[model samples]
Target: MATFNLKTVAALLFLILSGCATYQTKVNDARNAIASENPEQAVALLKPLAEEESRDQLVYLLDYATALQQARKFKESAQAYQKAAQIAEVQDYYSVSKITASLVLTEEMAQYKGDDYEKVLINAMNAVNYLEMGNLDEALVEVKQLNLKLYKYRTEAKKNYEQNPYAYYLGAMIWEAQRSFDDAYIAYKNVYDIDPNYGPIKADLLRSARLAQRPDELSKWQKQFGESAPSVDLKNSGEVVLIFEQGWGPRKESRPENRRFPQLKPVYARTQRAKLEVANQSATTNEIFSVERVAIKTLNDDYARLVGSRVAGIGAKAVLADQVRQKNELLGAVAWIALNATDRADVRQWSTLPESFQIARMTLKPGKYKVKAIGLDAYGSESGEQMPEREIEVRAGKKVFVSWRSVR
Candidate 1:
């Protein structure tokens, strides 16, 4: 039998445990900054790790890109998002070595590849970044990539994968901006199919149909909606879309009873919804996607796999400890304690993700108008929190985009 060095094993375990904690600590600090509505501070905290390439670079990139976007560093944010898309992708088949490490130590022992829904969100958010940069080609490319991945997911990951309404809705907006009314209509149909009850879906469908010259679809919607397709004077009225984020995503907390699996808990939020006001008219935002629900559901969906892995890891470690104990009881006991100490769950996530995503749209006459994002409570009352007034020049026959975030 090979001789085992108790001191060496203990030292190594200490390093791994402390290293994971340190990295998570940095991410938590950044998350706190974001929650405080100080995105610049959050970016400063994560900028070092996010700018570098590392094993945990995916986490750094996701949070960093979000922070940069909130800080209005769109170009730099786009670069981080681009890097994450290219390099941090997790493949279907992981390396044996990675699996071995995870089994021997912790799931976090392997690389921190993002979750399934997160991967799709990356493409959608990247498309937004490209749109903000005025690069229509790249924006469209990102949307196309998002749909392709969604299709693969339907056949590969889940046989009956439910469509993400937000992704398709975003694609519709982009297509409309590019004046591809036909394509926009198709994407809007996907969104409508996924969420027939969404407040703005009907209006968007009617508008796209009229613009695309689909008389039959327009008449069909007109009858079903019990309203006529509102006239869209393409040469006189411009479209304005406000994509806003509310609150912050939940935080992961390790339980004392089961450190091997972390529990997700909601983070506090002072703002729930927002209203976009321009000139004299305003539109109330509606929820499109919810990160809180999605995050909980994602973890719950993985519970079975996590349980299996945890049981196998503990069993293997217990057998090894018993083998060593047969030779030397004290060393065997030490081994058991040390091995169990590293059984921590990987609690890392995209810390800067919002609790939910919302949108508001308006058709305005051509003018340079001041736009305001006024935060509101569940009852539609002002919440005393607001975004700085920004100006938007609505050009005739064109669409424009604006985004805001509220977290306190």
Candidate 2:
């Protein structure tokens, strides 16, 4: 009887040892599979162990969650992570245990829905709570880790859109926030087509798609979405104020003869006729004029005549002087120019003029003109006669304002 009892006891001990060896081997294999980045293999190895009676339930759950995450099974991975977290809480393990749990939950929440959609939503809510509590970095870390999981969820949800059409809509929002507009557009469109009762999202998707064709339209849509349109400031006076910057010098004479002749003489003799001929020529023809050292005779002409005559390249220079003298007459006068809505974009054309002037104000047509000061020696005779260019546009009955700055 004693010998029989010893044999039974030894056999039972041997069986128990063998079972432990098998469990340890399987656990080690699963770990190795995970190390190799083969989540599918790890899962295949660990699932049976997780179900076994001898293995630690918490260890099984944690490994399973890690494997699912690696395999891009976000929903399942999230559930497993939650279970591991619960186990950790039950065991009172805080640091790495809680952190890992929170990270998985956050990522799952950010992802599109899957079979574990409810869990994902819960975790996402928790993540938001954590973020609100000033643990943003940790919450973000969770979001980062779940990228692959979310991608898998998106792919799966797309394949079965009828099961949850809302997934595509949510995906679109995620993509839009990330600035992936193209993908977002498609996703939103899908949601609109599949589910008409999606409330404002359908209209929003259509609007976004239309506005994407033009930037201006996009701005309008954005304003409408925000429930605030930009205010347009309209001036009732129909007058534009021209503020001039000081510090422009007169055109320097190219030669001594430039100083000898009256500034009006050379301009009347040469420049005006040349410009008229050039203006009359066919647009296709390209003519080049060589400007050697040229001189101006004088600066004395009404605005109309000054604008008309092109002598001595003096038409532009004459216009510049007239503008200065007119401004000086006003004594701290400012030039006002009338502009139409179309004129705003063209106002920069005035900058092409010589250094003697700057644009001050802009208004639509039907405006008046007020000029300021023309200082002495404001006009110069030099080798290079730097004349300011005129950029003022005037319509019938509308006034434009301009100011002159003397060149030192």
Candidate 3:
């Protein structure tokens, strides 16, 4: 056998460690493209990157699909999301090589499986995309899959996990549209169970109860709120629900509490929410959920295990370096530097996500109307940012879904 060349090995390790880091520059380019309202450019940048079945696959897939969705290519977005959902189904099931690297070095060296919440959002986002494409059937399918995923997560985690209220709400709406009032009532009830405080939850519940002939539920709500359900003559009225995406979701950074594993960094969102105007009536959005908050909680949940694994890995590398030091001091020093140089918290996250999800709902008589969406501040004042005026035709007894996004 040939003699081991420590110098050559050390030099090669240095190069490998340095080169194995993420494509931060490319990711930033795609982010900049989306922020500048140029999603096509973002798509071009991430198209090839997403094809690599390596550590960055999930991140790139998410960014690419998000860009496609932002560009209003609903069909394309749905396809991309479908591909992502398949990968997410097998959460944390990376290849043997990825597992070895993660164990020997850092989790950052492994394929990014995404936070649990992010995995769930894959289907939730797809459900909405299906809604925009006016394919209620597919939307329902995605919702069912999303529900199944959440069920599995809760069972595995052995506790309650977050449920997407918007998904449930949309499912209810779709069921009602299909005249499946009984199913619609249950779906709406799920949304209420998750968040009864949601501004429109009661109104929706009341409507669903009357439609489904749930007299007891209707009376209970009426007594509690001391008000009847807002009369929406479903036979003649039309409804619209707006899903608003505002600012950017939280990012991860090293924090004092646990520097070994990153913490959720605060997002400085300029626009807090959005305001919608239609048919001489308007409603300001309310925060349904904070993606950033969920992100922080998930990070904390995984903190202890990750920090312990990282410490053990570093300790093993130190011992190896010490053993090598007895043979060649220079090579040992280089090897130590190379290994520790790449030691960092796995901060990669789905940066394209919105800071929070907000919603606005309205019911109007069937007609043609011009709709406008304006960004707002914390105090219910306009932020001087708005989507272009859009005209929507509402048919009698039908519902519509509209989505607006702002990168504040």
Candidate 4:
């Protein structure tokens, strides 16, 4: 009876030892697969091990979460990390729990629909904790470090995106933050090639590509892309003056085709007495002549031309005003000073403005100012000219006004 009992005990011990050996072998294989970048295989091997009662479930769960994250299954990785954190907490593994929590938070942040910069930052801190754990292999430590950088980039990406949705080039920006120039180049190229207009994103894409040392790619894109669209130019050089006249015309949509020609109505005028500081010329010349006439087709066109002209005069100073039909009407008009152009100068439209009827006001320094009032018919055709070059002496800081009236 004693012999029989000993045999039974030895057989049971043998079976237990064999099971332990098999589990260890499987864990090693899973680790090897992950090292080889076969995360899918690693995950398959680790999933059953994680569920096995005899296995070290904590290790298996951590490995599985890492694999899931590598696979870009952020939601599932977050769940696994959550489980790991809970297990570590219950086991009184404070350090492990913190690291797992951080991983979970990182994954969670990646899944967030809105800005997650703070959460990503927190995750990066947790990754640092894992690095200090000493139990993880060097490769895993490297991954943790890489994750730290990725999270930071994600945070920055979210912030930039929030600030400017049009800056969707942020995807490439995040990749570039990871030092993955190839990935960043691809991402930026995608944004650049997208059909939707993203304001400055195209330029950003080109700039990033050039920074990545892809001059050929930038050149190719430049060849394909058109010139940058024009914008309003505003700069003031010297004491430039603009006198705006208020009037209304028929809407383009309401006008007949044949009658929709460019109008020559005088929108504003300047006296020959006004002075302009031309670049590189030492002498202040009275070459500025009174504007005999000006015309605009639409109110927005007029306003855009006016504002852009004003903005273009950044290097020059402007004392200007518009003749508004009423004080309230002046509030509706957008005003800007244009520099560089001498009196009697002909300036073309740079950008189109909104189409609407509006009023304006003009303020000028004490001086003799010449004003021209021109009118446009409903069809944008030049109605006969009105008040050609009216001269008025403006007191310092006083308001100068001019207006155009449409003939019936």
Could you tell which candidate, 1 or 3, scores higher by lDDT? 1
Model 4: per-residue lDDT, tens digit, 334-353? 12111111111121121011
For model 2, the stretches where C-alpha displacement exceeds 4 angstroms are 7-12, 19-24, 52-55, 91-408
Show model 1 residue runs off by greater than 4 Å: 1-6, 12-23, 90-97, 255-257
| C-alpha TM-scores of all predictions | 0.93, 0.23, 0.93, 0.24
Q: Tell me the number of clashing residue pairs for each predicted model.
A: 0, 43, 0, 30
Q: Between the candidate structures 2 and 4, which one is better when assessed by TM-score?
A: 4
Cα displacement (angstroms), candidate 2, residue 370, comes to: 60
Give per-residue CA lDDT, model 3, range 1-408, as digits (tens). Answer: 114655567565775657555555558888888888888999999999888777688788988898898898889988988888777667557678766566555667777777788888888778778878888899899888878878888887675587878678778888987789999999988988898888877887888899889899999989987889767587788877788888888877656765457877777866898988997899888787778888888888887888788878788678877887677887778767766666667778888888888888788888898988999988778877787788898877777778887886
lDDT of 1 by residue, 46-107 (tens): 88998786667888999899999888888888888888887656575466887776786787
lDDT of each: 0.82, 0.35, 0.80, 0.36
Best to worst by TM-score, what's the order?
Answer: 1, 3, 4, 2
Best by lDDT: 1
Q: Which stretches of candidate 4 lie over 4 Å from their true place?
A: 8-16, 19-24, 53-55, 91-408
State the TM-score for model 1. Answer: 0.93
Q: For model 2, how does the per-residue alpha-carbon lDDT over 1-408 read when each residue is reduced to its tens digit?
A: 556545644553443344333223445666556545465898887677455633155446555655654455655665666654454334323455433322322111111111222223223322322332334344434443333334544695442212233335434444443445676676666655665554455345544455344456446546655643322222332323232322311222212443212121111111111010111221110111101111111122122342232242233334433564464532112111110100110000001011221222233444333323222222321212112443443454223333222222
